[model samples]
Target: MAKVKHESRWYPLESGESVLDGLLRQGVSVPHSCRAGACQSCLMKAVGGAVPQAAQVGLKETLVAQGYFLACTCRPPEGTELEVAGAEALRVPARISSLSFLAPDVLRVRLVTDAPFDYRAGQYVSLVREDGLARSYSLASLPREDALELHVRVIPGGAMSGWLAAEAPLDQRVFLQGPAGSCFYVAGRPDQPLLLAGTGTGLAPLYGIVRDALEAGHTGPIWLFHGARTPAGLYLRDELRQLADRHPQLRYRPGVLAGGTRDIAEGPLDALIRAECPKPVGWRAWLCGDPQLVLSLRKKLFLAGLSLKDLHADSFLPSTPQVGASPAAAGAR
Candidate 1:
């Protein structure tokens, strides 16, 4: 049996069990998705073990050199010990510049990093408070916009959300880590049709991506679907409408759960999206928001002839006290 140590806990790895399986069997919660090793979400470093050779497959050379390995695919040889990668090495200083509501429950948060941070439009950064509580939020502002912007939907009773909405002091300082995830607009695909869909504050990342695509001079059709529970939840309505009107190739569609007298569709957003394009062949797609919604739409897009390589997603999982997916239960791919 391999002896695996994660944090302060130790587990006896059963024969043929991967490190992740062992950790999970011991009741350790590790944030992970696409456990097949493709997403790189369960990345952990080998502190004092012989990491399996296969664990480094497809990883960047720098990461490999730094002793990083995917816990999902690695099985330690007998007598190996390991630990979760330390996050302190990745955090940088940031300060909240402004906080204002986009809706009754959602706040538009703008922060300025102590140093310039370069990231793609659809990536997310994890914000850490002094108490060590942290949550990820997608960047809604573009790189050229000169600020780090996020749309934070205040969850009732949520620790981070409650403080930020009601109790946070002005110019509060925090630490940020990552411009992480794989969902963003890539350069040189100017003619490829792009599809962006999300529910609630999930629109945050999509909003940035739309502007990035337009700024890149993409000439193909760009479709956006922002889902909400009601008309009042449809934040940024006029702004998105004006944006669409200014760009002939952009189409903005807001979806509502309960039917109402508006230009938006009623029902689940994915159903409305399918009604818009029954066949999504050759189109690149990005999905954020609810985990079930992202997973469901991902499958539908694949069955509609979209390749997995062309579909990117970020499904927000509920945050644990020490770690989290995102503030609004949404993340960027």
Candidate 2:
């Protein structure tokens, strides 16, 4: 049997077992941003063993040929050995390091682990509840933070949020996997105006991006616009405003998108953007939140004069983290 070893987290169980299998056997937690191949967060490279093809994971062709595998999918070929190398590539084994109510319904929790790793801002982590239900959460800290911060809006009956609110608390350990997904801030982006767009808790990663950009010494104009159904749903409005306080070049714009059709025209955030910068063809766009909102804004931005390449977005696909589905249901085009 093939032997699979993960370097980031300590492993137990016998060799040749699946990565998850080994993880569960040892009671060692790993973060997974996605169980399905659609999110690259669970990706692991096989240094030695042969792994079956997970054709749906969206891994680049070159990576697959080079023996990269998904811990959720591949198992080793007989007599082979594999290792999921690097704390950066693997998820930090952590518990709910801290939890606090950000709003009546929003909880900000941090997960701390005993490892060092790196990921671009805007990535996510998957928390596997006690009952094995998994939900993805965006990270809110810059790359160097020892603890990962997540902002979770407690859905009335969200399976995972329920666990967090009721049963889980400080120091309560759980299973998780992450540093997953390919959509995040691209370092080395040209210095230019940075457009930050978010809705709901999607602000998590955008916060991380802003922190990283400032630290990286980006002197370009930064614009942050958050559209909320109501002001209450905007979790960190004051925080963003506070950030703008110190950076004279940084601007924060908040709006209520659900007010009224007439209100939307009157508000005219997109139009205001065009008026300020007649041609924003080269500015970078970062958007996160409801897929519909992201889609609409993307279309509007492109129409207003932004190139598709200049736009980077993370569109949430509401899902239950179900175990299996037919080929068509797997989110492949």
Which one is best on lDDT?
1
What number of backbone clashes does candidate 2 have, counting pairs of residues 3 or more apart or in separate chains? 9
Which residue pairs does candidate 2 place in steric collision? 30-176, 30-177, 31-176, 31-177, 31-178, 32-177, 32-178, 41-180, 41-181
Candidate 2, residues 54-136: lDDT per residue as tens digits? 52255556666766666655554566555665233334457778888876777888877666645677787666555444567
What overall lDDT goes with each candidate model? 0.80, 0.65
lDDT of 1 by residue, 32-116 (tens): 4445555455567777767888988866677788887777788877766666554456568888899999988888989988888
**CA displacement after TM-score superposition, residue 130 of candidate 2 (Å):** 5.1
Leading candidate by TM-score:
1
List per-candidate RMSD values in Å. Answer: 4.7, 7.4
Q: What is the TM-score of candidate 2?
A: 0.71
Residue ranges of candidate 2 with Cα displaced over 4 Å: 1-37, 40-57, 60-91, 187-190, 258-278, 321-333
